[model samples]
Target: MVKRQAYQPILITDASRSQHDQLRSRQLRYIVMMSIRAACLVVGAILVGVKPPLLWLWLSLCGVGMVLIPWLAVLLANDGPPKEKYRLANRLHRSQRDETPPRSLPAEERPHPVIDAEQ
Candidate 1:
């Protein structure tokens, strides 16, 4: 008698986001960050003209925002989704399995037929 394996249901939660969706999200994030940087520049210019009480502090904050936003935005835009735990585990398991020495059959165990060279 043969034993049957249990059935497993496919779960939608296991699926990763599509490339197009991921790209769109990243693009939106980058745009928002750049917009913030532009706002910082405008605020800095306004601060320069108005000369507020804490003029130096406000200008320094805006300058920092303008300088940092682009660097962070670029880094985030280029970043890809992290590998799933099961995916990493499977890769490691596969590599380890491949590295194991292959078994070889003894001469007698290997199939061979006599070759007649004098025929």
Candidate 2:
């Protein structure tokens, strides 16, 4: 009688998020960052109009945020999830010298069927 193999269950943790979900998340992050940048511009304008105390410092902070946020947002939006450790490209490249040579099984022990020319 042939033996049957046991069933193996797939784990959900191993699955990656869908591309649409990932893209939606990245788009949301970019929008939030841009919103913050707009807030900085508005704050800078308000500081200029009011001539607040330490006006230069307030303007500088806002200016820095306005300049840096878009650049950072673009970088983060373009970035993807990190590669898995077990992926072939991410695995360490080993030289042939570091590996053990493949072992050959003896003819008597090998599972292949023997064919006879006389049969």
The residue pairs that clash in candidate 1, if any, are none
Q: Report lDDT (CA) for all predictions.
A: 0.75, 0.72
| Per-candidate TM-score against the hidden true structure | 0.69, 0.66
User: Per-residue alpha-carbon lDDT of model 2 for 1-119, expressed as tens digits?
Assistant: 99873333333432467789999999999999999999999999989999989999999999999999999999999988766554323323422224432335443332222232222
* Model 2, CA-based lDDT: 0.72
RMSD of 1: 15.7
- Scored by lDDT, the top model is 1
RMSD for each model, in Å, please?
15.7, 12.8
Clash counts for all predictions: 0, 0
Deviation from truth (RMSD, Å), model 2: 12.8
**lDDT of predicted model 1:** 0.75
Output the TM-score of candidate 2. Answer: 0.66
